[model samples]
Target: MPYDFGTWDRNCNAEQSQPLTGTLTGTIPSWLRGSLVCNGPGLMKYGDHEFKHVFDGSAMLQKFTISETGMTYTSKFIKSFAYTTNTEHQQIVVSEFGTRGCSVTKGFLSKLGSKFQFDKMFSDNPPVTLARFGGAYYATTEAPFLHRIDLDTLETGEKVNLHKLLNLNSQCPHPVTLADGATVNVHSAVGPLGPRYEVVKFPPTCPAGADSVFAKPVKLASCETRWKLNPCHMHTFGLTEHYALLPEQPLTVDVTAMVANTIKDKPLIEGMEWLKDKQVKYRILSLETGKELKLKVKSESFFYMHIANCYEEADHLVFDVTTFETPSLLHQFKLENLRTKGSALAGEVDSGCIRRYVVPLNESVKAAPEENLVKLPGAQATAHRQKDGTIFLTSQKLSDVAYENPVVNPAMERKPYNFFYGISGDMTSNKASVGKVNVRTAEVTRWDAPDDVYAASIAFAPRPGATAEDDGVLLVHCVHAERRRVSLWLLSAADLSDIASASFTLATDAPRALHAVYMP
Candidate 1:
């Protein structure tokens, strides 16, 4: 059987079931002892109705425990308020980021009620990423709250309300933990005037002494846009030792338009307007002082979904991202497009490429715009110095293949690192493979999946007390199209060689995961 992109949406119904043990193939590393946890859309339909977008599916958490003997697998749906309501009522009563309610009246009432009771509409899908913070594991989405899960049981715990805990409206699932064990993430809040962006830091452990009284997150930096509108749709941000980078794309949300669209029972994605003429703005904020520098660059309008890694050099801040030419990629995930196989849906969406951008920093915020500004060949360029100093901007394309879900060594984050491992494929192709790129050099190493299998993202597990940087193992989840089977492959990080694999049979095809994490 050949690969079918639509088969990935088949419901697995593996919710809150007993652990299925699988036999290991190849040689298992004696030192590899821990669990790998991943979360993504598990249930695509409720009762008789099916979700229009993949983002609307109920979040399911999957866990695989690795020991010397064999591997044990378990999965459960995150019993979020939205998931429970939908299952109990047999309908989508809550509105998601992309999927609206079942009826115009119900959608309007749900939106109205959300303003007073936030949890009623909160979709704790936690499908985006898995994070370990403050000595506890959390399943997080774009929502303001983080759903705590048991590391061993894969069961849902109490929902941590970020708004009440840190006065944050919403937070990105991708967070960077510092060397001192402090986890940091970017949060955004929209207001009548404009949107405010904040960088928050949470300590390793609760300093407040009680679970109920968690320590308040410390604000590292913040900035408000002047447009009185949300500055595009941001999935992740870049971080360095001394600076935080936020990319303000041309795709923006108008508060007035959104409110009106909500009343009319339209999907939230419909209200997003893409301004092709506007240049992308990169906001650089100093971690030490509350100073901000803005650099506007001109090029074909594009959107960034993930950041690979970022670091600082002499007087420059550099980062890499997977760039899409437009926002049409979101529309490609519609059920209608997924159902149509062959060339109709394949090679239709633009594949994303990894691009690197360098920004030179200024010492003072009031420096003249032209004093230290340097423009490279591109679309358009505007450089401005912050109160502290001036900064310049430049960019270059790095990889030939489309890359997404990039990951780096956790110890090397916010610092200089060379190799980056991620999922690579053509934007027009449905197949995916694992590839590692050496940033310093332009060389890339790839391990293409068989034509009958689709590969997901790779997670790096660093060897204990290792000396070299790439001295670790890469874990990837693969799904076979013919048998509807799922398998976990462990490869050598140095050369992409197959080290071991654990295969298991699933009742239905396993949905593709957006991201994964390995806990050792």
Candidate 2:
């Protein structure tokens, strides 16, 4: 079966269930009966069955659900961390590092309540994904390293160098060339790994790739600065955690530079897209042998979208694809394609079924938009696939959002930082919308929220006794237009429609494209 997971974030001052009571399955909390109470931080604090915890950067945790008895408040947790020091970018944080440590309300309450200032163990970069191994949690960090933590005891552990496993330093050359017989110490870095933005692969000792987290990550291959001079380029895969997929972004230089010192008007954006024909390839690496199986696809017809993992009675994989200029489409495949015999045609995997969805921008809205029209190019929206094969994708239809900003991309003109150089669209927006896609029917539905509401992060809340038509709730974390004020919204999973909206406080607003985790 194919599945797509989605989330919801809304704006409103609503009630919450204190002293959370009830049962939780998967990531959804069952709310009993309770009086309508004002909200606090949405964190799932575990005090006296309260289970309160503040999401990182949030002033207060937004309660997601309450039991009819007012016993439990289900919530989600978004974390940030600091890693080791690197003076190279001054912008990269390295202090206060820890796995699943930096949270919003905790950052604030620690200051006010005289708690152990847990903010110090911050990660150098935000975490992309976290895996649990040997009772410990291992998370990938921007400092290009993975940190280990004790899941049961919440204790810190060893750190593994991700750059080393990817063989970045060895595959790419050092001492980048400079003018006047000089060289600058330059090295390539690995991009984020996950569904849409990173390399995809199954971790360790898992029978099926779908629904399995990376248990033990082994190195596959590496690249020099291919995407750009620094190449903050990230890739995505189609198979569940089953296969390791690496897309190629060729490395180019100042082709016109060797001839004359004349300032070639060649722009960086154009440089990144130079070889539109060079296809994005992937490698399926054996966690045991370190041997890689390569696969190439028809680069022109399909650009990478995201990967979905399915683990029902059988294992399956879904790859979301879109043309360089088309709607997002999903392609389904079998998980066997990653193995030796079955993977021979790795490059020949079926296009399977295709599902495409595009946010209607040019169309007129029944209600006048509160702010300036939402900028286009939200084309960079992210998606989450639910276990039931439904897909929820955020769209660029929110108001007050700047779609393309010249100010943010000034570095692209001069070869700015690897990742930031090519970043388009304004992630900042008061309002945003999410689209729902049915893998079986290829049908599409949409839900839009208020302006200044930042709900880029979404998730699927566990449902009970509900069918595919009425089984799940979409959970979203939204920052209100007022700023520093965050809220939550529960949406019916089946139709991508709103259920309820609640408001809470945050120490600071969350970064636009951050990750959130749902704890049952």
Candidate 3:
């Protein structure tokens, strides 16, 4: 039998169930305390209206609190304009990443007048992930609007649009938090100098009463895009002790198409086009001086999904991230493709692998076009100066297995660390497995999922005073695809072994989620 994709068509948060205890199939750790707060797509469709892409669903916030008293689970859908308006109208009234209202295509005449409904042409639903800014939690997507939600009750708060403070249309969902409580994220904006990207910082403090918690953001650095009208989409970036590495991949957002699509009553994602032949530019920004280092770093084009870690080692900046050979990863995720492709959907993303890239730190070093500048030992990566003044980066696979959402110990972030855990979108197949990877040895140890079980990404909670990097328990949100059930599984981080003694099963099958965080 093929995998069931029915969950993609259902709204998982229609009912309210909270403080529900799990019928533990395994024993949960007695010492575990705190909560696992998660956010992702939940409400995928409404009356006569359905989202086109998996990411087009409405934001669903979930919480699993672990204590000696046992576990409790609660889930609720965020009241974004997309969700409320669609529910009020009994159809999709707003345009999502790839889906628009049927009225959009009723006739060319209707589309021409959709210009008057430009407000309905965009959406603020944040189904991507949970982000922390200025000591407050928010559900964030690629859009400028972030829906603030209380971490304890999952209640929605006032929305903050970064555009109100800075002229940015899109914001990176994955942001790097600094030691001083400031959060740094990349933003895309177009001004007098055509298209450009900026590294913006939101300090820990906020005004007593303000419209935006991110008002008066400090622009660390900005760079012009290669194209005059299009800017490469940035999902995430790399941050070291002193530098922020921004990858300008070939996948771009066409500004002209976006405005035209809004006026034409078309989905915004139609403006996004992937240029596989374009080279990836690595723009290095100095953290201290808030300036761009004039280093022409370029590499063969590839789509980067997430940066696991970046650090300075031996005068070289080393970074690791999940890479896709082409933009097919995103293209293959359309709702129609997921329902029809089913199990094959897992194989589409299996081509993604973790890649290690190294860049030379010296500002004024001259080398031959073919001479490798990376001298750090045991690193199979290299950087050679090209004849065109471009420092070409060549990377090596950190592990043989392909994975998504590669994560490490939070304490070991932005520094060298071994043993990173990974989870797959489809764990029922043999193509990808939930496991741990040894970066130094390139050794992968996996815990294969049983039949009909799919897994989310890995979240870690470290054991107290533990010296080993993988000392705590690993948490994974698993769906029993056939049994119509969802649960939180705990595994011994020391080894990817199932801790049958300490896991919690949800009252019902959860809507699909891409990422989660362990709050201790």
In terms of lDDT, the poorest run of 10 residues in model 3 is 424-433
Candidate closer to the true structure by lDDT (higher is better), 2 or 3: 3
Among the numbered candidates, top lDDT falls to 3
Backbone collision tally, model 2: 70
- lDDT of all predictions, in order shown? 0.73, 0.31, 0.76
Q: Provide TM-scores for the models.
A: 0.89, 0.44, 0.92
For model 3, how does the per-residue alpha-carbon lDDT over 115-144 read when each residue is reduced to its tens digit? 445345557888888888888888888878
**Cα-based RMSD of candidate 1:** 4.0
| Cα deviation of 467, candidate 3, in Å | 2.2
lDDT by residue for model 1 (1-520), tens:
3335664556655563787787688987989999888888878777787777777788887777788888877788888877887887787766676777653235656547553355533455677878878777788887797888887888899888877775666787898777776788888875455588888888887776556423567778888863565556678899888888888888877666767766665666777788877767777787888667555333345787788998886666667888877877687777767777534555676767777776656344555765544333331223445443424344567787667888887777767778889887463444567888887765789877766666765688999998788899998877666545777889898999899988877666576677788987
Per-residue error for 164 in candidate 2, Å, reads 6.2
Q: Which portions of model 3 miss their true places by more than 4 Å?
A: 1-10, 102-119, 207-212, 344-350, 425-432, 501-509
> Mind sharing the TM-score for model 2?
0.44
Best-to-worst ranking by TM-score = 3, 1, 2
TM-score of 1: 0.89
Cα RMSD, each candidate: 4.0, 19.9, 2.8
